[model samples]
Target: MNTKLKHLVRKIRKNSTAAENILWKELRNKRQGSTFRKQHSFPSYVVAFYCYEKRIIVEIDDQIRTPRSLYNHAREKQLTREGFIILRFTNVEICRDLESVMKKIREKL
Candidate 1:
């Protein structure tokens, strides 16, 4: 890994956001026999959550201040073209009811 990427991974490991921590606990140890990595580097992009075995990428959208629908749509399209399935959930959804989110992920898996 490049120095920047190594640093980013370290940061991800050491300073996971609340949602990332909660989700990582479930995703670690191959929860579905699928490995997950945080702050995964893609082509010129950094994904929040990635499962290579399942070809899935999960993005937790907080959207605290501005609308990101347009940009997210573009990113989703790019990932789809690259044979990745992208799943997005709002912070509210993740914080309030993660089981449903996990179920959605399993469905994709």
Candidate 2:
């Protein structure tokens, strides 16, 4: 990764959302079979969580700005085309239905 992206990743990691922290607690320590990296930075973009063995990226979709929706849609399409499986969870979804989220992730794995 480039120096700028690396720095951005560090900043993001340090300033995680409450939902991210809650999910991280469950996803850490290889509890789901393989280790997951939080705030992982790739050449294309930075992901909230990633598991290399499962080729899955988990994103907390709390923000709902319309201006970025088109861009996010394109990014999602490109990531899928490149063979990456993405799991998106809203803040409410994670906070209220964590078990269901974990179940879905386990199924993906």
List TM-score per model, in order. Answer: 0.81, 0.91
| True-structure lDDT of candidate 1 | 0.80
CA displacement after TM-score superposition, residue 94 of candidate 2 (Å):
0.7
lDDT of 2 by residue, 1-109 (tens): 8999988998999888889999999899999988899988778788889999888988888764232377668877888898999998888889999999999999999
Query: lDDT tens digits, residues 1-109, model 1?
Result: 6778777777766866678778878788898678998779875667789999889998877754133577677777888999999887776788889999999998988
Q: Give the candidate number with the greatest lDDT.
A: 2
**Residue-pair clashes per candidate, as listed?**
0, 0
Clash pairs, model 2 backbone? none
**Which ten residues in a row are the worst by lDDT in model 2?**
63-72
Native-referenced Cα lDDT, model 2: 0.86
Candidate 1, position 34, lDDT? 88
Model 2: how far is 9 from its true place, Å? 0.4
Candidate 1 TM-score over all chains jointly: 0.81
lDDT of 1 at 55: 91
